[model samples]
Target: MRRILLGAAMAAMLAAGGVAPAFAQGNPFQPLVYVNDSVVTRYELDQRMRFLQILRAPDGDRASAEQALIDDRLRLFAARQMGIAASDAQIDAGLAEFAGRANMDVEEFTRALAQAGVEQQTFRDFIAAGVVWRELVRQRLVPQVQVSDAELDQEMQRVIETPRITHVALSELIIPAPPGQEAQAMRLAESLVQSVRSEADFAAAARQHSATPSAENGGRLPWAPLENLPPSLRPIILSMQNGQISQPLTVEGAVVLFYLRDSRGTLRPGAKEQVLDYVRFRLASTAEANRIAALSDTCADLFVHARNLPPEQIQRQTLSQGQIPTAEAIRLAVLDDNESTIVSQGGSAEILMLCKRQSALLAGNAQEAPVPVTAEGEEGAAPDPDALPDREQMRGQIFSRKVGQAADNYLAELRANAIIRRP
Candidate 1:
């Protein structure tokens, strides 16, 4: 299933230049297929294929591009049925947004795309379809997604109660398993693993071959503790060292290979691991750091002048050391309670004050301390009205995923009932 982004669709057309208008009789608008009464033209199919090519999709296969176009037509037809066609202004807005990604204005992007061979109208149509479908999904699917306070609290409690574990920084390549194509995908994945010698090579392979959304980022996963990983994959991860690639492992509906980038031990705070109380202050200039060093006698007074600033600008949190990102663990570890250290990440420097540290267990093999479940008749404790930012982000992520799945399922239903014809 293609997630039709306006930018990607536009890129395809621009990269391919415009489809040659000259046909058998100098006529380009030839019917390639029909979905019910709506038609997909040969010119449109060729343009989409070129778009997919510029995307560096697997093999730039014509069949896949054709399938994507067919789906786009279906999406457009559905939009009309719902009386929700995109306005011309909406299409322009989408085109402008897409151009912004390339740091270009719409006029500049349009000229560049034209030079590359894509027609302005073709790009506009692509943007219109995506814009309309997005509106349709927002109207139909978003209202159905709900994340209750109880659900958030239960998850938060679970995270706090789970013990800390060694974390592995990993990247993955996932090739889709489309029924009869499973064996072929596995063989390809195996070949990739054998040929990839470095992180760059693996990332390049992922961009060209992976079917997962993460392919856009070269399959890099966020830093995560091993305990949070799927049980079946954890053992295999533990066996591999940094920079090592794993053999292809088949999971439900896909074949996956992992590359271990780095590893570290961390405590997950929500799992109720040992909490490290710390004060953090962000620094913008060396002068600020120097001024603070000269004036502050203790960690408490370091932020005395900045107390009126936003709390998040200098907030204090009691968190697990294991919960600290692998990159900052070393700097934070060397400090004692109330002692402070300075570290810079992504060009921004910050000072960390170690307020307190509690030992729950050693570096490895920490056992879980069970949280008591209340009796069936008693009312459970009211969930905190204020959920963490991470919890809110997770909720949004879950909602988006549900909407995507609902869109796919809705499209499948449309395909099932429509009279689809191909020539």
Candidate 2:
């Protein structure tokens, strides 16, 4: 819930200028509800409703919008007590980060939103409140959250003891079904699935239609491990191939369409494959691409250029051939060390530079190699117990979850104590 709120708030920061027409001076904005001393105006509620629409907020409606606005009021109230608010620089940086997700700059994203009928100030205010709330949560909660070494060991042990499983990349479109609208929702899902022939089409439909928070991200979900998916979904997911879209899946009160983007096995049994280490530089514009093409001589030189780009514009990873996207993988297969290849996706061009390569037996294979692929001197070291991979990521996830839960509970208490009245 906290993450969802943060995403909504961050979306608010996409544009920083513009103003909504104010109520006539004789009458202040008419109050809809009061949160202690703070009153929520009808105008604010209407603005929040539109804001939620842009966020593709799941279960979004006037009621949810009202609750969300009330919660934000509570959050801002708390932030005031803590003296936590976003600075002008922090807000600009947040705007840049949010725009990056859409492969755009602030001006570009704002222009896109304007075309979609969303005002600039709505995003700005949403982001400002969200930024301040995040700081408040971090300052108050993160220091108190801890993951013991034992906890990490237990998680690692679980991974080792569990059987090898496949993970999948997925996109989804969901339609909500009210008590009597089940058949209607199913029909809608069916129609949508039949019409969406390509991934871009599916994403477009999801952006306009899905009743889930992921709709804002074109229904894209992370690489979800099979075991982590619902029991009923496992069989359906297992039967899907890349680019396949599922039939309408009726679950609880929603009709869903899951698009299988990609999938891979964790243990390839007896498979032996050459793994490669590479850096993919995603340039912001063709101009940047031309500049890099002229100046870059070695794969290492890309990092020098990266210093001027946002971190999301660059990717460095080690992956087996199967893990690379088909077209890019084919290009990588022929590239020598320090050689680079270019490809375009979503209007951005990516330059992939091969760094190193090594052969390794997969997890289920009898042969074992400590390192997949690495430069000399980087390999041969015993694993450091203190330097656990994804430790910080795990800590951050856990901390965020705790903060979210704590915030939920705190907000509930605040509502209970506050003199809330429908005016």
Best-fitting candidate, scored by lDDT: 2
What TM-score does candidate 1 get on C-alpha atoms?
0.48
lDDT of 1 by residue, 1-423 (tens): 122323333443453444443224433588878888778787776666554444334534667767777788888888888899888889999999877765568997778666645578877877888998999888877787677765654454554444334787899899887666654675577578669999999999989988888888998999997879988778788777789998767666777889998888533543334556777788776557656756765667867956777777686776576677775567667877677776665556677777765544322223333334578755566543222236666556666777889889988998898889876
Could you tell me the lDDT of residue 266 within candidate 2? 52
Q: Where does candidate 2 stray beyond 4 Å?
A: 1-28, 167-256, 259-371, 374-396
Per-model TM against the reference: 0.48, 0.46
Residue pairs clashing, model 2? 12-123
Locate the minimum summed-lDDT window of 10 residues in model 2. 360-369
RMSD of each: 21.9, 23.2
Highest-scoring model, TM-score: 1
Error of 2 at 283 (Å): 74
